[model samples]
Structure formats: C-alpha cells, structure tokens
Target: MPKQDNLSGYNNTGSDTSVFFLSGIPGLEAMHLWISIPFSSVFTVALLGNCTLLYVIKTEPALHKPMYYFLTMLAVINLVLSATTVPKSLSIFWFNFREISFTACLVQMFFLHTFSSMESCVLVAMAFDRYVAICNPLRYVTILTNSVIAKIGLAALARAVLLTAPVLFLLRRLPFCQSHVIAHCYCEHMAVVKLACASTSLNNIYGIFITLFIGGLDLTLISLSYVRILRTVFSLASKEEQLKAFSTCFSHFCAILMTYTPMVLTTIIHRFGHQVAPHVHILMANFYFLLPPMMNPIVYGVKTKEIRDRVLLLSHGKNF
Candidate 1:
C-alpha cells in the first residue's frame, strides 16, 4: 500500500515520509487504474507480437537475413522499452508513485532514452540493408555479412548507452523544488526536469541537442538511404520488380513514420497546446508509446511475405 493513500489531502505536509514515495498529483489513484487497463493490454500485445517476430526470424532459416536481423534487434529494443515504463507506470497509477525511488527514476530514464535511441539506430541500419539489397544487390552478401551485422548492432548499442548516459549524470546535479507532482503519467525527460529547483538551462539545451542528434541525424540518414533505394527501384527493367522492391521497404517506412510522427506531434502539442486539455495529452502519450510497437508486427506481417509465411508456419506445426 502507498503512504500517499494515508494522506488526507494533496497539500498535507504534516507527516514525514520517504523521498521516493510517489504522491502529490490530484486524482492519481483513479487515473492510474483507468490508464493501467489499456497500458497492460497494449504492453502484452507488443511483447507477444515482438517475441513472435523474434521467434519467427530465429527459427526460420529462410528468414535469417540482414533485414530480419536488424528487425529482431528493433523488436528486442521495443520490448525492453515497453518493460522499462509500463510496470512503473502501472505502479504509479495503482499504488501511487510512493514506491519509486530517485535512483529508480534515474535508472528508468536512462533505459528509456537508451532503448529509444537504439531503436532509431536500428531503423537506420535497416535502411542501410534496404539500400544495399536494392542498390547493390550483387554486394549485399559481401557488405552485410554476419560479422558486419554484429558490428552494426554493437555500434548501435554503444551509441545508445553513450548518448543517454548524460541524462542520468546531468539529472543528478539538480535539486527538486517543493512541487513533486509530475503532470504526466511517467517520469519523462521533460517531466522530471520540470521539478528541478536549480537552473535547468544547460539541461534543456542538452536535451534539445540530444534530441536533434538522435532523431534528426537518423532521419536524415534513413531519408538519404531511401533516396538511393528509390533510384535503384526506378532503374529496374520490369514494373513487377519495381513494385516488389518498393513493397519490401513500405513496412519499414511505415514503422519509421509511426515512431517519429507522434514525437513531432507531441512537441507541437506541448509547445502550443498545453492548456488544451489533460485527456488530449494522455491520449497522445498512449499513442506515442503504444502505436509504433503494435503496428510494427502488423506492418511486417502484412508487407514481408517471408516473415508472414514463417509466422503462420510457426503458428501451425509446419517446418519453416
């Protein structure tokens, strides 16, 4: 049980309590229960869906290609990202934020940014795979060998860790103000930073720079890769070949859009629409977290014939 529930009202300060006791925000209990249902539902679906994707790729020899390797990495990252937030979010909602320690929040934020950035890197890797397959088909095997793919995955992981380490390091220096209430459902970068009593100018600047570094850089690289892919597709002699090449990349494009669009929209809403409504923010938050993972498996299932068939084969007792 949360110590916050024992409190009579929001502003009550009589009782000395643990620093980590998640309390303060109004109507948290009701909000937590309300959000947990959908959060759990979507989290379960994402976990199972991504796990099935990993299994299909791993078990099916035919699916063991560079594209699927990167896809599996993406699935693993999403699975980890969902785990980092959903349980804590549920705890925050159901029992109040009393159980979450400052160290835990720092840890959670670190993992969240790490996984999210890694997903971006994986998307770029997938784009490179597509570029190679379409633009230099003859060299696909030479360029994207097992060793090369392993290097790419390792590089992505290292970059994610290095890029997000600052978040924890920088956050540790700030002192919390009196208001401990985070407006949103989770301990997001902005949400936690907002509680700082000290100067956050450097944090905000670093936050924006990091956002641009990860998001903008990856998007630019992916776009350039696709541009080359488009040229290669157009050069194909047959319409069927062009369509097939485009179809191969359609799901990836969809996944990219799903992942980044909400972020852009959320920024828009936060900057221009703060006073709009609370439910709107909640809806956007849920969509930001849920839509990409839920849609990723479906996109792959519908677009990639080999993955789709393998998933079906695994569903039944058929050999892949």
Candidate 2:
C-alpha cells in the first residue's frame, strides 16, 4: 500500500491502502510522448497564428476597428494560454511524469484558469463589439471607441486577476497528502485539488464559484448580446443587410462554440460520468484547453473576409 501506487489496481481497503491514482497508469511515459507531440504542434501553430493576428492588427490602419481590437485581445489571450501550459506539458512529457511541487502546481493552476477566464471575457467583449457594429451601425464607432475598448480590456483583465488571484491564496491553505501526483497532463485546479488530504469543501465551493463567475457569466453575456443582435438583424429592411449582419458574427459564434462546448462537456463528464475511461478525461482535457486557440485563426480567416484577405496578403508579403 505504498503511496506511490495509490489508486492503481491494488487493495481498496484499509487506511494504508493506496488509492491507485491516474498517475499510476502503466505506459504513461510512451503516452506522454504521443501527447506531447500534439501539444507542441498545436502550440507552435497557435504561436504563429496569434502572432500573425497581432501583427496584422498593429500594421493595418483599416484593421483598427473595435472588431479587430477585440480579436487582438483574443489572440493575446490565446498566446498566453498556449504558452502557459504547452511548454510545461512538453517538459513533463519528456521527463516522464516528473514530480511538481505543490506550490508550482498551484501556480500553474492559477495561470491556466486566469488566462482561460480572460479569454472568455474577451470573447464576450467581441460579441458585444459585433452587436454594436451590426445592430447600432451608425453609433458603433462612438460606442466602441478606443477609450471604451481600452476600458473593456481593463475590465476583462481585472475580472480574471481578481478571480484567479484568490485561488492561489486558497490553495496555499490546503495541505497535500503523500499522493501529490496529478491526473491530467496539466495542473488543473480540480484535478490537483483532488490530491488534497485536508478538508476540501472550501476549495471545491470556491472553485465552483469561480467557474460560474467566469464561465457562466461570460457565456450568458455572449448569449444575450447575440439575442439582441438577431432581433436587430431581423428588423433590417433589406434582406442583404440581414444576411451580412449575421455573417459578420459567424466567426465570433464559431469561436464561442469552440471555446464553450468542450468546457461544458468536461463539466458534465466530470460531474455525472466520472466513471468513464481515463482516456476520455485525457481527450476532453486536451480538446477543452487546446482546440479553441488552434482553430481560432482558421475560424476568423475563413469566415471573415477581412481576416482572410489580411492573411492571404500577409502570406504574399504584400502591403495590406
């Protein structure tokens, strides 16, 4: 019943019985390399994609609109998120489940959550930007000016910092047992907290609160913005204008689905289907954290004409 073998296929009784955690799964070293390959690959793509986005926004005067400003914020958040996890995850893969100190794990969890929450907030801002452009076209510039966009940026960063900073303090109060290994590829809050031997009611409660505030709040705002936008679009006198308005929001809508769907799926699986295969958790975790950023540039470029032209022009080294 050694602690290292906790949660493996061992005795499931007695105080000394190991819990056989997911870290004890055999051949994870090999699996780690497989996992790391995709992680590194996507990280590279995200870096290039988001950097291109930032560059296009910075250089192009025409791209200096509210929509592109919010897109820039999303790109920045994506860069941070990919940088936060992918390098550490790659290192862990090469090292074969290396032990992370409790403090470091907590720090990773905090960064991951903070960047994710910030991305969600930025997406909500993007939705609002689109709403203004489509529904309030005449005043879109006045309403979503540089000053207002700056304020929105500050608000998103503030929400993420305020929400995630407290998590570090909360984690500092929790004591880890001998079984300190985490289950997933990264130091996720819930997965790491599962290793705590101390009373975790407070941590769980606070985690739920943060999740709701970040995830639920952002999703609800985006939904409400779209509802108003749809109403206005339908009220347009010209069918062409209605189609154009809806088409303009398509990229943002795709981004929302890519970001939120995996999260909602993970929440449901972790709550109601914990008994599912470990591989399921691993797959969902990767998708939840990785896919959105990886697909963002494609979503925006393919669905939005301006982005597509910029990307094509950049590819050709043209001044566009």
Candidate 3:
C-alpha cells in the first residue's frame, strides 16, 4: 500500500504540520462519486490514447522525422501531466483519501508545473518545425536534424527545471501558518501558495512573470511562426498545393487552441473570478488539465493520414 500522511496534528499555525488535506470539490460532497465517473473516464482515455500514440510513433519507422519526434515529446509530457494529477484526484473523489504530506505536495507541484511548462515549450518547437517545413522546405531536414531535435528537448527540460526551482525554494522558506486544506483537486502553484501565512507578493510576482515570460512568449512565437507560415503558404501557385500545406498545419492549430485556450481561461478565472462558484473554478481547472491529453490523440488520429492508417491497421491485427 502507498504510504499515507496523517493530518491530525496540523492547526492554524501549521508550524509542525506533516500533511495537507485536498478538498476534492468544494461543497459537492454528496456528488463526489458522480464526479468521479467522468473524471475516471477522461483519465482512462488520456492514458490509453497517449500510450497508443507513443507506441505507434515508436514502432513506425516513417515517424522518425523531426515533426513526429517533437510529437513524441508532447505525448510524453501529456502522460506525465495526466499521471501526476489524475490518480490523486481519483483517490480523493472515490476513497476520500486526501491527506497529502507537505513534501509530497511540493514534489507534485514541481512535476506538475514542470511538465506544464515543458508542454508549452514542446508546442513552440512544433510550431518552429511547421514554420521551417512550410517556409523553408529545402532547409527543413538540415535545420531540424536529430541532433537539433534532441537539443530542443534538452533545452525544454532545462528551462522547466531552472524556472521552477526558485518557486520551490520560496515555498520551502515560507511558514504555512494557516489551515492546510487545499480547496482544489490537485496541488497547483497559486493554490498551494495561497495557504501560506506570510505575504506571497514576491511569489505572486514571480509566478506572473514566469507565466507571461514562458507561456506568453511561447504563444507569441507560435503566432509569429504561423503568420510567416501563412505568408509562405499563400505564395504557392497551385490551389491544391496551398491546401496541402494548410492541411498539414490544421491538426497542430487545433492542438494549440485546445491547450492554450483553457489555460488562459483558467488563469483569468483564478485571478479575477472571486465571485465565481467553487465548483465552477474546480470544473474549469479540471478541464484545463484533462481535456488536452484526452483530445490530442483523437485530433492527431483524425487529422494525420499516416497515424490514422497505422491505428486502423493495428486495430485490424495487422503489423503496424
């Protein structure tokens, strides 16, 4: 059995605390089981879908290109993000096991934020791949070689680690002299920080800066890359060629919208939706984290002919 933390000792001071209580969904105690049904379904789909994506990409030699390599990284990050949050959420919803130790919460916060940041970086890398393919087809192979792709993956990992380290350090220094009941499904940065007794202005400022710097910058670059890609696509002479180029980007565009739109919405609600119902906040947070993982594989499976063909072949019991 997994080790469980005891929360009986925690009080208003939180000085000698060992555990934090995760309130699954505030004021929805009677319907916790009902809520678990949908959450469980989504988590199951996310796990199977992302695992299938990774397996197909690994087995198919045709997927060894730079675009699919970046996709593999995206799948890994999605798996990590879902795995980090969903199991604990289900435990809370179904079994009423919500006492998470302080150390465990910090660890969860680190991986959750790190994987989220890495996903953003992976999307930017995908955008760059598409930009090169559309704008400079001749140099696509030369520019995004295996070496370059590996470097981009490493850089994404490094960025996540370096940027999130300070947040963890600051959290460690704070004296959490308050109720340790986290009123959400998972351990989020702001949610956890808000439980601290001391002023969190610096933490808030740094958090905002990182959000804008990493996520904002990545989104801006992706937009700019697509702008350039659009310019290049429009310059093509044949209508069929233009459609072909744009079709290749349709899946990625859908993915970007799904991943970022909910994120932006959730951030806005977290910062400004003080009057919003607790369940509304929790639902949006769940959507922001869960929807992308569950949807990305379906998007790619439908949009990409190669992956679609492979999936069909595997389902029919032929060699993939």
**Which candidate wins on lDDT?**
3
Q: Which residue pairs clash within candidate 1?
A: 21-98, 22-97, 22-98, 32-93
TM-score of each: 0.90, 0.88, 0.95
Query: Candidate 3: global Cα-lDDT?
Result: 0.87
Comparing 2 and 3 on lDDT, the stronger one? 3
Best by TM-score: 3
The list of candidate 3 runs beyond 4 A from truth reads 1-15
Question: What are the per-residue Cα lDDT tens digits for candidate 3 across 1-320?
Answer: 22323333443535657678887787786788899999999999999999999999999988889999988998889889888998999998788888788899989999988988999999999999999999998999999999999999999999999999999998888877778878888888888888888888999999889888987899999999999999999999999999999999988898898889888888888888999998888888888678999999999989888888999999999993
RMSD, one per candidate, in order: 2.8, 4.3, 2.7
Sort by TM-score, top down from the best: 3, 1, 2
Report the poorest 10 consecutive residues by lDDT, candidate 1. 9-18
Q: How does model 1 fare in lDDT? A: 0.78
lDDT of 2 by residue, 15-95 (tens): 332222235223355466677777788888888888887887788788888898889888888877777767766666665
lDDT of 1 at 245: 94
Better of 1 and 2 by TM-score: 1
| Backbone clashes in model 3, listed as residue pairs | none
Tens-place lDDT per residue, model 1, 1-320, is 43455444422322422243344233445455776788888888898899988888888888898899999998888888778877766766666655455777788788888888889999999999999999998999999999999999999989999988888889888877455555555567777787777899888888888878988899999999998999889999999999999988998999999989987777667656867665566567557678888789888988888888887877787883
